[model samples]
Target: MPSDNVYPSSNGPSQVDDTIPIAQGQRTLFEFGSFDHSKIPLEPEEWPVIIIGSSMVGMTLGVLLGYHGIKSVSFDRHPSTAIHPRAALFLLRSVEIFRQLGLEDELRSESASNFDLDAGMIIVEKLVGGKVLASMQESDPAEVAKASPSRRLWLTQNMFEPLLRKRAKEFGAAQEFSETVVHYEELSDGVLVVVQNVQSKSYRKVKTKYLVSCDGNRSATRRKEGIEWQGPGVLGESISINFKADLTPYLGTRAKHGVTYISNPAIDAGFRLESGGKAGFMIVTRAGDKKSFSPDSVSERDAKRYFKEASGIEDDIDIKVDSISYWSVAAFNAERFMSANGRVFIAGDAAHVMPPTGGMGGNTGIQDVHNLAWKLAYVLREKASAALLRTYDAERRPVAGLLMRQAYSRLQKRVFRTVPDEPELPDIVCEIGYRYPSAAAAHIQNPNGDQYEDPHAPLVLPGSRLPHVLLSRDGSQISTLDLIKTNFVLLTTGQSSPWIEAAKGMTLEIDSYSINTDTGTVRDSEGTFSHICRISEGEAILVRPDGFIAWRGEWRKDGHRDELQKALERTLYLSGSKQL
Candidate 1:
């Protein structure tokens, strides 16, 4: 446990004067505060983890860690909300994570529902000619729904961040606003971070076991570490405009034209994002050529001009400009995700960046946090060796690289050429196909076939998230995901005989769920018979705290007890009487 007062001592050279005032006029009201370095007792502080950046990746990491009882701190340089909305689509896997954090309802209530639409397509054309040149259709929504109940939610960054931040704060995460990282040094044991208050002319240094950088494409931490981003620099430039208006009258006749590619000889190419009866729409056009458009440069009048020209409408249309942003599409992967020093790690855009053609940015970042958080908790709690930390890089880097490639491929197909008959859109990669192949995963055999298999495939084997299976228990159909709470769940078939009796003397760390082998009857907490599992003779599977299979075998086998003990030992990192 760390004492609250253990602030960083003024280190070597004074690159920044402590008296310099940070610009706070641009910050929110809640962002005004000085660093509280009061020395407080370190009474087993929740997993002390520090995340830099407060966007989706940062907020997701904070909430997830907090849910697992890990104390987290997140910092962002921005005074208020981000002016530019980057990502707008949240994939199914992300929705599932939200469900785990008890935030699914809030997200569903706030964001636009997936409705019946499964996958969407991107269209490209010259804005002036209003001619469609190409289109890349995504996977069908009905097919995706049949595979899993989860669906992608469409919402802008503006609507999503506030909700996530609220949930994270509710779960005991300390979020510092208008605080920017000035400098960070990786000590042998932990990382020391120095942050400056934007309003007050004060600075504070925080020491934590691990530091995760969720900062965007221009990551200060990555720069400080001198890790170069390798790949194309500026692939293309795009101008995005968000406005509130009613374009339903014009679009109702051509709803199938969800994406209209305006190709005209006079203007640049562009596309439209329509939703909720055109309550709001985002129009994007390539930069340069005869048209002038930049997030910073484009004005309200300019936006109206482009919208009218693209939609071919002459009537006076009321448009409220919410925001305008300029983005440069590029494909880049960090030279490395984990530091050779091992105390600092990069995630989200900091690790890999891609074009928004596929909306893989936020989804991949959330997955990055998912991979890192649990491993950090395990290692910090001493349930696993520090070696587990290396797996973070091994697992996420490849996934990031693959996603970036997929995004680039989508970009190429959408821009330079037409959508092929069998367009290879890496939707699954963005959905759920990522897996960790480190020593931690080595315990289980790769049951899902190869790494390149469709990511949307159901997880049913060891090392994979248990697939959600429908089960009828107590006259109600339940999802397998609902069965596992925030603890290790041991599911067994048949009677709770000697096997259950033999495990009774141990600590109450495991929860048992038994089902009758013959009738598929489930024994709940109240000991009532409810049909859940198949209940076919033999032993059942034991799932780890993180939802991976620990062991499975017949209950009466001689080594069954030994296997259970081994599984417990490995999962909990317990040695003899000493528990990590």
Candidate 2:
């Protein structure tokens, strides 16, 4: 347990004065490398939401908020998207959110480069002529199809963050790189964020209705807010060498695969690497007590030597170092995800930390913002009450806690060999088991006491994702997920349930769609929706913008219109009779 003084006296590490701040108007790249500072504002940014990181999670928040016309700005101390091999794997849940922004196809194209290589992890005897120890499958296509239309993509943060950044900007969000949030405060009404240009050492104040801290594990915002994380801290440190080499000699026909793990007792450390196509491999191994891999300290020779020794290569291979990084593995969950008044919130590693073994650190963070973004948008747009915002923590913390433990457990299984190496949690369970319990969700039947239930179970009880079902929308085939938008969706059957009438008096963006109604209803070509979601003719399913089931109308309910209206009112926290 972290002591009370762990955070009571420290607001995280402060930016030590760079021996010298970049001189004003000087035309050289700053100490942190290069960033397009042209778009950075000289004046303070005033937006509805201020995100203090341009990480994948932060960018997703910006994109989601922008799509909803809720202006937001993101700032990062780093010059640009991760140059190092940080978080790479993205789950279908993250893909679904990107799909909403119309970037899913583009993302799929990027990951198509080495799909087979990404099939699973391979434990080898060595990088060169190594014996295969084990092969782990990340997901089973058949089981995955039953839960979600989207599947996990093997794309690194370096390759995909820019796509999100571009899409975010397209959706009207602004970004500032090399700008760090040094301080922040939640006032009676809004949050005031203080950001500084690392190069110029100049600061500006941003005042916004909300402040979302998507910064990493050592989050300054979280620390300043006195939000302490709970869980075993800092598992250990590792060296990640982003080096380019012709591994064709070693992997040969299997070069197209993404991940390769080498184990050799002769070598002091083993290699866990993911391929970066022509770019290179992001290799990780235990770091020395006093030495770490860094662009500044690691020379080409050093990187190649480290790679050769860890990979058990007898001869020095021709390798070029790109950018080396050292990172600590930790599993931590914040004491609380939100401040008392809810003016400030934390997401991503700022809220929780996870080991890289599960490839869920970044994916989980993306989902976090996706979950919070809409609720914040609705509250800001006046579609939902302020109380709805409280669900952000109530919903995400449980999942975060579970994922933290799971990631740590995976690391022990893979690295330390202290735990059973049976298999990681089933893909469906890790990706979709989490359910929200709050005013925003109304489980009308078979409510489970657990925060997360087995996703592989054949049920779409309220609060879970409306199971992916094939439906025909007009002439095109689409999944049940495609029907969900940035607002509430009331799904019913061919009878054109009363939900359509009930939404008439509502101010919310609630649209009614029936499975097989002749009056402009989407046809359930396969009857999958009815069978999987357990909905027959008279039943109704109300889905939130995030695609979680908000309410379920019992099959025999004679008058569901009023029930739906009341349920909507309760779920959305509407003060009056007005509802969807």
Candidate 3:
């Protein structure tokens, strides 16, 4: 654990601007801090992990790390969660992760269930006329459910972020809003971070074992670390008009659809339901393909005009414009995710930026922190070596790169009417099918080169997500994924008692479960677990803490212990724990 001792460090504010936007709507209902900058402690502080930025990705990381019993402190320039409903789409894979944190019920209640709607994109002349120009279909609900326990949801960032902040607090993460990370210095043992109060301009230092920056695309930490971006930089920029208006009358039957693209000579934009259709927003200007509307220059008259025109409701309605925001549609990946010293890491938009056509930017970031949280916990607990932390960049960077290209391709095809020659993976595959590179799965040698596998037909291969299988525990139905939390798990059939016994001998906290057809520890009443997972009698699959398969093969009577030990040691870098 990192010490809570305080020491003085001198540094100026970061060159990057860290301005806090005004609080919006009922956002203050869930404000993280009191917004009193004078109350900020003058002395330096220390923590195991100090997170920069407390929005979606940062808050999620704090919650995840807290869930693993690791204390952390997060700082954000924002006065509250989110001033605007920035990103609204959450893939089923992302929701499944939320479900793991016991947030499924609250999220599903607050967000619109995509499964209940038509769940697809439609290009229309206007909301009232509904003259279709083009359309795209979403994945079948049945197909999606077969891959995970949760479905996709449409909750705006403004609504979603509060939940994460609350959960993070419940898990003992200290979130200090109106605080900006100004500068950080990496030491051989820890990092010294200086943060300034947005209102008071008071500066304080934080010393942490690890510093994670989730400060969005223009991450000061990433820039300070001199990480360069790869691929097409900024595709374009657009204006997002967030507002609360009853669109049901204008939408009418079109309300069933998830997203609507409004196209006409007057304006080209996209619309989506917010707060479960009680309110909504519009993305004006294709950005990459059209004019870049400046958020500052968008007057109330202009915003109302665009809103009414996009809705085809020129007749006045009670359209309350909440906020106007601007964003870039870009495809860029950082040259590297971690600083040279490896004490500072970047996740979410700081690490990779992709076009929003596929609604992957925030989802990808959620998975990025999910992949990292457990590894940090393991190393902090001395269960794994510091070397295990390096795999976070190796595993998540490639996945982010793949999604970046995939999202760019979708932007070209869906918005621009120009299909890229590069093959694009199906949306489900992009969300959950991505396979970690072979180097991340050091226990496996010469793994397949495929970037992703079909989620519908999961191979349960090493470096792949653990295949979802329905099993029963205490007569209650559960997913194989449910068995995974914050520890390595060894999954095998009832006949693989040798593997279970081998796991028992290890001092590490390795949870072993035996799935059986009729009678065993975990009953596979559906009798499809072995077939779906491709595991037979005497065969076992070793899963990592993050629920990715670390190793899988037939268990040998003479070498079961050695093989399991070797797999754990190699995958966790346990053999290289010189720091211990």
Per-residue lDDT of 22-45 in model 1, one digit per residue for the tens? 136231222212434444233333
- lDDT score, residue 580, model 2? 43
The candidate with the higher TM-score, 2 or 3, is: 3
Model 2 lDDT tens row, 1-580: 1111111112121111111111272323222222344444545556899888887888888988888779999988777775445566777788887777788899988777644434567667666677777777666778777677887887777788877776777888899988877666678888766678878998776689999988766665666667777887766555565666666566664454446666556332443344433345545554334322322344455556667755666766676665545466667898888888888899988898877777788888988888898899988977778888888888898888877887878777766667643345665677777776644686343455655667656457676877778888767888888888887898877565665666665666687887763546488787566777788777788888888888877765456556767887788788655544
Q: Give the winner by TM-score: 1 or 3.
A: 3
Most lDDT-accurate candidate: 3
Over the full model, what C-alpha lDDT does candidate 1 score relative to the true structure?
Answer: 0.61
lDDT of each: 0.61, 0.70, 0.78
Q: Considering TM-score, which of the candidate structures 1 and 2 is the better prediction for this target?
A: 2
lDDT of 3 by residue, 281-338 (tens): 7888643234765335566677787877778887678877766666667788998999
**TM per candidate:** 0.79, 0.86, 0.89
Candidate 3: misplaced stretches above 4 Å?
Answer: 1-45, 113-118, 275-277, 286-290, 443-447, 576-580
Ranking 1 against 3 by lDDT, winner: 3
Tell how far residue 559 is off in model 1, in angstroms: 1.7
* CA lDDT, candidate 2, residue 503: 65
Q: Which candidate should be chosen as best, given TM-score against the real structure?
A: 3
